[model samples]
Target chain A: MANEKRVISVIVMNESSVLARITSMFAARGYNIESLTVAPIPDSDMSHITIATNGSSKVMEQITKQLHKLIPVYKVIEHEEMVEKEMVLAKFPIAENLADISVLASAYNGGVVNVGKEMIIVMAADEPKRVKHFIEAAQRYNPCEIIRGGVVAIER
Target chain B: MQMSGAQMVCEAIIAEGVKTVFGYPGGAIMHVYDEIYKQDGFEHILNRHEQAAVHAADGYARATGEVGVAMVTSGPGFTNAVTGLATAYMDSIPLVVISGQVPLSLIGTDGFQEIDAVGISRPCTKHNFLVRSIEELPRILKEAFYLARTGRPGPVLVDIPKDITVETGEFKYPESVNIPSYKPTYKGNKKQIVKAVEAIKNAKKPLLYIGGGAVLSDAYKLIREMAEKTKIPVVETLMARGVMGHDHPQLLGMLGMHGNYASNMAMSETDLIISLGARFDDRVTGKLSEFAKYADIIHVDIDPANIAKLVDVQYPIVGDVKQVLEEMLPLLEGVDPDRYQAWREILKRYDELHPQSYIDSDEVIKPQWAIERLGELVGEDAIITSDVGQHQMWAAQHYPFDRPRQWINSGGLGTMGFGFPAAIGAKKAHPEKTVINITGDGSILMNMQELVTAAEYDIPVINVILNNHFLGMVRQWQTFFYEKRYSETDLTFQPNWKALAEACGGIGYDVTTKEEFDAALKDAIKQNKVCFMNVSVNRFENVLPMVPAGGALFNMMLPSPELADSALEDKKGTK
Candidate 1:
């Protein structure tokens, strides 16, 4: 049950300490968050936040309800059907086979976005699950560094 | 219409219909206190400590069903009120604490009497605000009131910086708040309500498990109607002590750790449980896996998170308890009552077999006897508050509370010093009603300084001290669980409470016998001013019918052999 991942998007008033209030609630309840991201919405005094956590249906329900209780939180959306994405950038040594890395990244709807003298930078923007798998598959190319962005979600 | 933050606070409080606030003043909060001094129509009860102020405010809120307000300074002042805030938070009482903070610039620089007021109080509060500007003071204050008193009420805190309190800003108290996410669901889902009603009607053994939520939501009348219409037996949790009259045939006494035997047994045997506003707390549920193992639970609570948090709720109705009960009552009419009669008879037999009785000794006064006698004199309608311990359990067991809010105790947090200050708050809210604080030796000393507050303010709340000269509850636990290694539970060096009360300008009495107790209690009630009565009780006595921690509710430990013999003798005499 703990392995089942849940994605929840919270719309909140863009204010100081608002994020603390929401995150503290989850911490107080001892809920674990796997990945989180927050950014201000365009042309509004609000922010969009996405949290990925592992819990059963019951824990997810509790997390959602508690999030709704926070003052700054305008809405809590537990995605039943949604388009979610995570970005990962992997830098591989230039001497490593570039053709094989491109094929592996392309399989996950991703490809090399940059080619440098010292390293080849590959970017993958796909489902969080696939992005996770892509990182595991590209680990063999002697990747110098890997950066994983937090999950960002939108309702379909 | 420009005003300082302090003045706007006063304005917002007035606009929010807050006529009274319990608080203590200090350097950090001087501006607000100064404003309070200049303002009219607000009664401020200055308590000895910040902790007691919050407790008094909590007591006021619980007794009056209004949002109680408490104000204090920064740093140590806010930290001192942490226990009171936690108590109110656990019990879901509506309270607002306004604290002073260091000026915005010195917030993180470690200035004099500065602490992270909001951060320290975050976990214990339902929500909190740290005022960064004077312009937002009015809105924050308004929101604080709304949040504290709204659905599943809990405490909220507002921390104001010293500079903000002095800075002037345009004061426009909003006529209404627009928190779209904070709306509480009042109307229960129709499908769930119907399903719960059907389950109740068809079940052979149905029980109504009432909690503090039922009392807070004022669902007593609706609960009674549902019980009578459906012929279902009802059992209450500690917080829902007076859900039904003590003499009601269908009303089983409280269930759980210190609950009545028959009620606990009935809970184990029930086929369906109609839970109203009561969370399945550890104390109430005992062993989680063993709690109501055979029954299908129908949970009706306003907080969606509360549903199925512990027990698997078969029918979850997310709404206010009162509104849900109102909607479910009509659906329960004309339900066949024959099936429940047999279950009722079985429960009646269980009650008859093990009546809740305690040892009555003629040589020494017993705590149970003192409480029973006190109940007779005070009557069921009198408001009673209790500190946590053996005395609290005795009071809950012996006192017959006939109305909602009549019996107020620190249920969830079980804070020891909660009784006296809370009784002061209750008495202040209901000036004509008699308010009694049933306290113990250890608990009375926790916040005994509040006696000066009562004496100064002319709040005539009766303090009944069951002086056993030991921390009775811990002593009992040590005796049972720790192999009689009584660590630091002994409290023989306690102060002379009677002399202390007298020194504080309150009348005091020392009673050792039942006759003396009766006389002293009557005298205290008649005096009409602040009075404290110290009733000496047997130091070794333990609360009977106690369910050991993690023990099944149905499997309760009864009185020991010596006490059992005394109880039998007393029963024979009564017969």
Candidate 2:
């Protein structure tokens, strides 16, 4: 069987050496991390780091343990059971029928936020994988801007 | 400690250690340029063309591993930089080409030089930006530099409008970048590393397949150490040529269409394959389904999607080569080889069956011999650039390099005018190093304006034109594949070599014979000016190991077996 992948969330001081040290761990030891996400904690001084890596359960546990040991790490949680969502805001041409775009957006938990004289801004929040599909389908409307927000997850 | 976004961008670039920039000035970018002029650290090389500016920056980046920097005005200036930016992006080189945009007040109202630079470069760049305010310039520039230099390195363009550059407020460059979805994996899995180690230990015949990643990630030393420890033979891809010492006892030389017999034999026989840093391009693996059926392959790379895209990968490690090797090194401390005695014998037999050797014809000086002489004289260390043609094929076939960046060519882009400008750029990047631009008469003529750049810089780049009086590769295509009805391949005439060089303010020589070529090359290397040698060659020279359009590597047009036989017959007839 293939190794299981772990998604570990790291809370840390939003500082320089933290990212450098974290990446240096990967670079120096040659450890392969599958996916990584980092964002500031809204109004807090700390940043939230979400790292996804494939390994056995033991290795996953060890990884989380080691991450917690790092100097800047404030919290480490393995997202074994979580409701994860990702957001993507796309600006499509105003020429596309508004009704069709609204229907597409609402279905993905989104809607048209604004309709300037020349442009339409549509924001969508969905499962990360589904967000990719939404972006792919939205290509028909001829998107001018695509801004993908960091994935945020909370344990189910 | 604090400034506006525009000031932050400047500070970030300074931190990145960029010493020079090439750009064309304009009104839209006056704010940034004003900040630039006020700064006292770096000088900008003003280019006559925006496209040339980006190309020079790209050339600088490829020549030096440092990120190449360029700036251009809005709209058309940005568009011109796009082509050069795309070129660097496609080749996976680190470049930062910043462009100016119209002010926010004039952004949507058909402002002058206000093309949507970010939108235009979306597909061409790793990442790009349009700063809405001066407050974020520091963060954006820091992120741009980080993104440009990380993972599979490529171009990143930051488009700042004039007003934002002038707007000032509290500013501080971010200490770190936090892009959520763009994490690149490094380091091999311990289990897979063990599996690979066990496979290597058990395989009767194991081969360590090398690729350009070795050179790019600076994994040559580790790869060498691993090969030595495991006693495995090494076969390099086109880009992986100089990653290992070619003369190593375990090195089987290059693999793929024109790969040496030893390399091909090793690939065909080995039961275990460890691909370090190469994408198995079709040129290397002829028929994917039928490629190395005997082998259990392990592919280690940074791009995850590339894992099982082609052939079946038994063990896939997605990570940076340098990081992966560093982790896997200690695991291979004392590994011992267990098999391959009989397989080596069979490879030796294949080596005897399909040997590679050059021919001597009394009538025409062979192109292959010239390349061999170039390799022998220049040694493998000189930076060699080639224009896309049959000569490119011959050089790939003959020249042996063991590192990544030592040999520069337009592989993915296969651009015609690449050699001249690229050589000048490489020379400019490393003024102390010897840069050789090898081109066909047709290919060299494509971007011959760069001869001015070489001359203006007073950079002595040796331009060796394999002048066959026709677009050699195209003519060869017509000869064998297209039924030999040579159409526009033939070129009628031009000024003599000395005259052309004199016209261009450089040194040039017309070499009609091998003796003339040897003497001219020696003198050309010693000259102070950019030297161009137009070597007159027999028009019918063809590159063997030809993979027709979409064919596999194994299916090659072997070198004409008739040359040797015809030579013997010619001697007999003369007698």
Candidate 3:
């Protein structure tokens, strides 16, 4: 079976080593996470962890079962139908064409997040797939550095 | 009322009706051990090793159908228990492991005996916790037991900082816990139950495939009732060994790899497979595509993920097996007496054609013969536990367990040293029952130190070692697949087990002949103190009627030399 990308978000108690446990479990299985993100759920003693990995359906089932078995994990949601997004910030010399970078950011439903004397930081928030495309398209502008926040998803 | 976290730990476990705990004390857990010492209700067994402590707890849980509890110190003490935790987890045995952690200030600072207990155990345990505060200690401890014993029943670990154990807090043991997301489905869906009944009614050649879940849910009687009511021949998995009577007329022996020919063949040809409390493990479902290819699988389990997880299950009923069977029995109301008479005749023919048999030797005792003899001597009521490998398979095949929990072994993890400590725990749970650890030369060496503990505690359990001088199971695999490339499977340097037992203040016997074995076993049972009987068996004799891994269940390798050779030649593409 060919490996396919899968995103799973786990709701877990905000406690020590929970993240280490989750990540090590994936590592033990030799399943690499393409992207990962963790943030405490507002007004709750829990956190939401989103992990993106590639595996076959069978492998995915095993991973899901393994995740569900973790002690702190309360819920594991597979992003079958969900709103997924990623944010990428691209930096360019202030001398670079500002109009082109602005158009590129706007195309990805984003805009300039910060500006400095020597460089311009443009941020784009969009679906993870489009975010990858945006980074590729912005490469023509001779970007200095690119910072990416990992993929996050919520059920639609 | 205000209570120290250590006192709360005692209260919480006492509230759960825990009468015994298996553990080893160390610096990190000194405070909790102090409280345990002060506590009057709990009977604590100090194991020589942390691994055995967990296995003992697992044994206690399996025997009593209650949550088994084990405690250990941080770092290596906790790490040693990973195998035991994983063993219980895979088999869905209820166990709660209480691990001592460094104080909060010392955590993650490379403090003495510091380790990420929760992280290390997360994969193996069903759930784990790090108590951050004393107030949460009681609730977390309570939850640990609750989660360990509820739902599909598995191992849970709670890592407590030493400071928390010494710290004081208001103690309030919650009458109940309501985890919003953790409620397990108990009642099977009525519509699904009805659909299963309809499928059963339509199946001419139906097979009842029971797993450990039936035993865990105490549904053995219900399973037997259902099987008898429907006249469906039953096939049990390794964990489900004692769930059905060994000699039940309608029962085909265990199924899948190393399963009986009649059972495996019946499974392959059956039109429907009613799987209760058993996952379709790869070992049970050899060559998945060819396993029960003709059958519509009706899977009934407490865990929803288990259903249709491996193979396609047609009718998935998610609930406790005992409760589901209760609902299902009325639906089956009555079945035709002659419905599967022809199917039964076919199974009977297969049983007669390929009966489980082995050649007897006067010089060297056969492992199978020793097990059969032990079975005869122990009667049907003895609670038997086994270490993993050839010995375990022999025990399952040779011994006829007529009740649930009568046969306990490390099924999923295939742990080697599990039998000795587990047998000890079983004896502690049922002091009147005859507890025996049927082990092997290779496996007995893994946790033989527990013999000292057994002697110290006066646990009068029998340790029957089938001395084969080699890792029998691995050697068998090598013999077949690797053309006898023995590698390091030989265990000629094994300790003189009889001498070792005697040195540990227990009686010991070394038997080389069948007659010696019978006499030694009888003598050991009569003495009623911890006894080790090392019986030398044929070193080259292999567990037979084997199903080569990834081969279809119906494609079993028989015991007869000629048949085994043909099967090997066929697998090698030389037939």
Candidate 4:
């Protein structure tokens, strides 16, 4: 089978070593995790984890099955229809094209979030594919630092 | 009732009906040991090493079908137990190991005798926990046992800090546990079971491929019934030995890397493979792309992940092996008993044409003859454990095992030093039953210190050393594949086995001929002490019927090239 992009959502019990358990499983099996996000569910002891990766469907099936085998993991879903987003923060020199960077951020459902004497920081949250496009477009502004948050997803 | 955390640990073990625990105490776990010192509900056997302690527990679990328990202290103690944990984990043995940790306050401060045990054991264990507070200790303990024995069982570790054992709290052991995320499917899907039954009914040459899961689930009776009623030939993996009696008319012997000619040929040519509890490990399914190419597989296992983890399945049933077989047995009532008669006859011919045999010499002992003689002398009920090597393979191929749990060894992990310690564990579990450890010189030396532990505990398990004075398995490989570059496989400088056994307060005999070995074995079995019989065998003997690594099962390197060539010719003629 050909390698294809996949996003998986895992619901697990919130515990001290649960994240380590999940990530260590990936590392031990040599399964590549492109991006991963974990946070506790509101008003509950469970946590939701989102992971993105590219692999053959066969490997993806194995990964999903292995995730379910962990004690803390409650549910694993390989999303067919879901809302996925990634956030990125970029710092560009104040003397550079700030207007162009701001416009680009606005196109990606983001805008300038911080302004400093020497640099301006812009934030963007959009679909993972669009986030990639926005990062590429903003590179022309000579961003000093770029921080990309892991992708988080929810079923539509 | 209020009590110290140490008391709670003891209370939990007592409530769980644990009769014995294997452990080695140290600074962090001294509190629990003190509590144990005061209690009389369960006996604690102190092992000389933490690794042996865990292996003993594993052996106890495998022999008795109960969750074995072990305890160790922090840092080096926990690290030493890792290999044992991995060995049990690989075989899916149910175990609960309690390790002492530095107090919670000093957890991340790099406290003395502290290491990241939970982190180290994560990959190896089925699940693990680091106890943080006194309040959650009882629940975690309850869950650890529950997880260890239920579903597809495996070893679970609970790392309790020193402070938790010192702190006092109201201890109420939960009568039961409810873990929503950890629920295992016990009943296979009805639709899939029906599909499997239909496949069995249609297949002209069906094979019942059994593995360790069948033994774990105690499903041998149901499997035998299904096979007899359907008249399908059965073949077992190494771990599944004794599921079908060695003398069963439909048995095709073991199927794998060193599997017999008939079993391997059956696997290659079968039209349908009804795999029960056996995973398609690399050793079993060599050259995966070519494995069972003509067969449609029906896999039934308790673990869903193991269903299609390797070979794709046409019918996948996820549930307990016994329960699934119970459901599958009645559906097999309509199967024609004579449907696979031709296939069975063909396989039986293969078995006869190239039976596992060795040239018996009165001058020197053949390892195969030694195992066969031991099997006969020990009777049908003796529990045999083996270390990994040519001896292990010889034992598996030659021993006449008639029941499940009769044969125990480290199959998945292939740990070398597992035999003696495991034999101690098994003997402890069943004091009246005879237990023996068949080990090679190199494998026995890995954990030979456990001889003292066995003597200390007064568990008299006979140890038979196939002393070739060389790493026989690797040397055989070098001879075949590496052009006889011996490397570090030779171990010419060896200690006298008799002196070492006597030093450990056990009896020992050095035998070179078959008659001497027979007499020593008889004397050893008669005595009430641990005995080591070091039998010197032909140094150049090789385990025959080997399928070279990454080769097809049908293509085997047999005892002689002429035999292998004829087998190849027969396969071609059949096609």
Candidate 5:
């Protein structure tokens, strides 16, 4: 079977060790996690976890099933028709072309978030695939550093 | 009412209806031990080692179908119990292990006897918790018990810091657990049951592949009913022993590595395999691609993760085995047993042609014969626990077990020291029944200290050591696959087992002849004290009918050349 990139969202009880319980399971089972994001849901004692991974469909099925077996996991969604977003922060030297960088950031639904004496940091929030593209496109400005946040997904 | 967290722990245990606990106490858990001393409802067995305590609790759970409980202290204490936890986890035995942790303030300061108990046990335990405060004690205890016994049934650990154990808290044990995220599917899909029934009715060579889940679910009766009703042959995994009587016509005996020829052959030839609560473990499914190749599988398990995890199934039912069988049984009423009559005859023929046997000798005792004799003497009601080795296989093959929980062993983890401690636990569970630990010479020494625990507790469990003077299982493998290099396999430099038992305040018998063994066993039973019968047997004995590690089930290495030739002919004839 061919490896395919997939996104899975898990709703779990907000507990001190719930994240450890999940991430360890992925590690123990040899499942690759490309990116992972966890945050508490609003007005609830449960947390939402989104994991981006690449694996065969068979392995993905097993992973989903194994995730459900965790005591704190409330629900697992291997999104089919869903909206996903990733955030990336890129720092560039102040000497770089500001107009070109702003235009590139705008194209990826982003803008200049901060401007410091030696560096300019541009933040981009877009579809995870497009975020990757935006990172590649901004490399022309001699970026100092790049910090990419994990994928956060929701169902359509 | 305000109570110490220790008091609440005791109260919670009482509310959970746990009558017995196995544990070893230390500094961090001293408060709980103090409470345990003051408690009136439950009895605690003080084990010599934390690992043995966990195994004993696991043995109790496996025998009684109740959530076994064990308590240990921090750091080394918790580390010692990890093997037992993993053993129960692999076999899906329900267990609640309580471990002490350093005070909250000292948790990361490398306090005396402190360890990351929860973090270390995460992969092994079904679930684990680190008690943050005394207030969460009651709920966490309740949840620990609930999670351990429910769903697929596995070991759950609760790491309690010393400060929390000392702090005051309001105790209110919940009437029921309501973990919104942890609901297990108990009722299988109705549509899948109908499909399974259709498959059962159409299959001319159906085999019931039963595993530890069937034993855990307490579904032996239902499994037997389904097999007998459908006239399908049953093949039990190591953990599923006694789900069907050894003498039952439909039982082809245990399948997999050390399985009988008939069972392995039937597994290979079956047209339909109705796997009940079985995970189709690699041991049972030698060479996954070739396993049950001709069969359309209908798997029923409570854990959805187990279904089709390895091999794709034609029909899958996710639920408790008993419930799924209950749903499938009624639909199976009209099925004719005559449909599989021919298939049963073929398996029966295979069984007769290559029956599990060993050469009889007057001077030297055969391990298989010794087990058979033990079975005859102990009767069918005896609860037999075994450590992993050649002895375990012999016991499983020769013992006449006719009920669930009668045969207890570490099937999934294959822990060497499991037998004696487990036997102690089994005996504790049912003091009236004859409990025996059938262990090999090498395996017995691993936890022989438990003999003292048995003596101290006055729990009369017989430890029958099949002394072959070698780590027999590993030696057998070396003999076949490694040209008998025998590196570290020879165990000739061993202590006197008989004297060791006697020194531990237990009766000891060193028997070489068959008559001596019989007499010693009878006398040991009459003594009603912890007894260890060191029976010397032929040293070269090997567990036959093995499908060498990754080999196909049909390609078994039988004991004799004639049997192998016939098996080859049989395979050719089938083709």
Candidate 6:
């Protein structure tokens, strides 16, 4: 098998040296992390980092094993049985014939499209993979610009 | 309806999603207690001491992967929590510790029960607050929970003056925390991630040195795959045991101080050390400056402060271990299979040569035999919690843990009284799994109070004291370093362990010989009650296949060729 991907959720202390220590560790180690998202947790002094990475089972095992060694690390967790969700927003040129695609945006967990004078914007919230798929599917629509948000997860 | 400040705090706690709080009640916290009675839905587990409460909370947090909440009162109540709170800080268990300070007007006056809870707990807690107003209650409560559970989570303390709870404000829980200085980096830098890939592709002998970070990052699967695909051998620190299947051929076992001779030797030989999530603790590195002298180290971790702290690194990837691994997976091109052939061969030679030899000549009871049989009989999956001593080292050396978090010890803190309570916590965490506390006699007695905690909770964590009737580790140092002064090492005060267990409301047994141990363990495993077995042997028994403190991994104490020959000759002569 090539490799499997793992979804890791990091609850971190947001600090100046914090991000540098974590990323440098990853880069220096040569472990491949696939998806990365960092956002402050709701109503707290910490940030939750959700990362998606692909590796052989052993490599991934080595990765999580190392996470425990970091000093600033509070708790390193990966959701075995969790509910993961991601969101995305895309702005398509109004002239690109996106008027009929409003329903497509809602098909994903997104809706409430805003039509402005210069551009048309659509937003979707869905599973991370599905959102990735939506972004790929929306690519042919001649998107004037696209922005994808990182994933957020909570345990079931 | 009138309510105590303590009661309001409890209600707010319940509202904040806490179902359990571990603490002991005292005069300073009497008001808090008044409120605790009015509260429902949240379970309040009364620990024997404030320390136990914090430890239990930590245990709960680790097992449940949620922020653990603990509460205590000022003075001794606050002081007693230091060990457990520090334990959490060291181990990175997320906890929200709520302490009751003296009434606001009496705060600095050092009232009879007053102590500077915040100042006292400064080094241990991630962040702390002394609430001055009732208006700050909701935000403080909200912030406490937020602080405990978020970025690089650690224990956070919120000290509430008794009066603040009496005061009230509109309870507004903020939707998001806006701390300008605190931002955790989750994603690895695109440029660094790319450079790491290139390094891996080019390195001749790329090895993965794993620590607890891999499990913390939840990248076990990714780690395993990366190892198998790249065929990178893994060297796990003692803390990282069970992050991967021990049976994995690529795994080289625990590395560092008492690490396998082969693994340490390999570290000297390997070109690149791909360290993820693990720090360069002294135990893992004989001397920090001399560690992995042969390797160009690559470190990947979610905590930015850990990178290049101990060892200078060629590349540092700061992001969650899981995230960093995903990015490097595809970029790694296949390296030659035989790249590490010579190193692997040498390691295999060391493994075959050393073979963890032990002195079996003595017909009397031996410590190594007991540990080996227990390890074999209990099976590799049995959770082995140990107190600090020679036995802890022996267990770490001999036992094979094929599960993550299975081997729980007081690794960084080296707390002696850790095993029994930790076993209790771990048992509570994984009730189905067989939890065993392998402690030295000296260490076991330190927290023997928790015997009642286990009995009260009906938590049957098997307590196996490697009883040597002395502080074995200390005594060993006396024997080895202090020139046999033996000083305060003896444990003459120990009551008959079997009788002691029965008095404490548990089953008890004793084993004197290996044969008796084999027979006793069969029934011991099935016993429905908490049990203690006094496996008696000579007090002089020592764990061999030894590495002395601050010594090189390769030098000394492996059955000196003459020692091995004499042992065989002595056995033949005895026969």
Q: Which regions of candidate 5 are displaced past 4 Å?
A: B561-575
Query: What is the lDDT for B87 in model 3?
Result: 97
- Strongest candidate by lDDT: 4
| Whole-model Cα lDDT of every candidate shown, in order | 0.88, 0.74, 0.89, 0.92, 0.90, 0.74
**Tens-digit lDDT track of model 5 for B258-305:** 899999999999999889989988888899989888999999999999
- Comparing 4 with 6 on TM-score, the higher-scoring candidate is 4
C-alpha root-mean-square deviation, candidate 4: 3.8
Model 3, residue B491: distance off in Å is 2.4
Off by over 4 Å in 3: A1-25, A28-32, A49-82, A154-156, B562-575
Taking all chains together, each candidate's TM-score versus the true structure is: 0.95, 0.75, 0.95, 0.97, 0.97, 0.74
lDDT of 3 by residue, B74-175 (tens): 989999999999999999999999999999999889998999887778778888898999978878887888899889999999999999989999999998
Residue A55 CA displacement from its true place in model 4, Å: 0.6
Indicate the docking level reached by candidate 2.
incorrect
Residue B468 lDDT, candidate 3, scale 0-100: 83
Better of 5 and 6 by TM-score: 5
Clashes of 2: 14
lDDT of 4 by residue, A10-118 (tens): 9999988899999999999999999999889999989999999889989999999999999999999999899989999999999998888889999999999999999
DockQ of 2: 0.04
From the highest lDDT down, the ranking of the candidates is 4, 5, 3, 1, 2, 6
Task: Enumerate the candidates' DockQ scores in order.
Answer: 0.63, 0.04, 0.41, 0.92, 0.92, 0.02
Candidate 6 per-residue C-alpha lDDT over B1-575 given as tens digits, one digit per residue, 9 for 90 to 100? 34445555776678777777878887667777777877685877777877777777776676556777788888888888888778777766678888888888997796988998876676676667778777756666777777776655688888888777666555555667665445567788889878877777777777799987776566788988888778778888776777777678888767776666667766767788899888887777765555666788888876666676567788888888888888777766555556666656766786777666566535666676777888789866588888888788878777767766677776777777777777776666678878788887788777787767677778787888777788887776676577668799888678788888888878677878788787767776787456677777556655554456666555435654333233343456588
Candidate 4 chain B has its poorest 10 consecutive residues by lDDT at B561-570
Which stretches of model 6 miss by more than 4 angstroms? A1-156, B1-8, B11-19, B333-338, B518-525, B543-547, B553-556, B559-575
- Model 2 lDDT tens row, B1-575: 65655566677778888887877778877666777888977766665567667777777777777888898889998998877787777677788888888988998788767787876776677667778877677877888888888877889999988888777877666789896535565676878878876776677887889876676677889898887777777888877776776567677667776676667657766688889887877778877766777888888876654566567788888777777778777877656643555766666676677656656565666777777778888866578877788778777767655455767776655667667666766777887777888888888876676666667668688888888778878877776667668899887575476677767779989887888889988898778579788887666666665556555455555555443233343456588
Tens-place lDDT digits, model 3, residues A45-146: 999999989988887887887677565678999889999999999999999899999999999999988899999999999999999999999988899999
Q: Which wins on DockQ, candidate 1 or candidate 5? A: 5
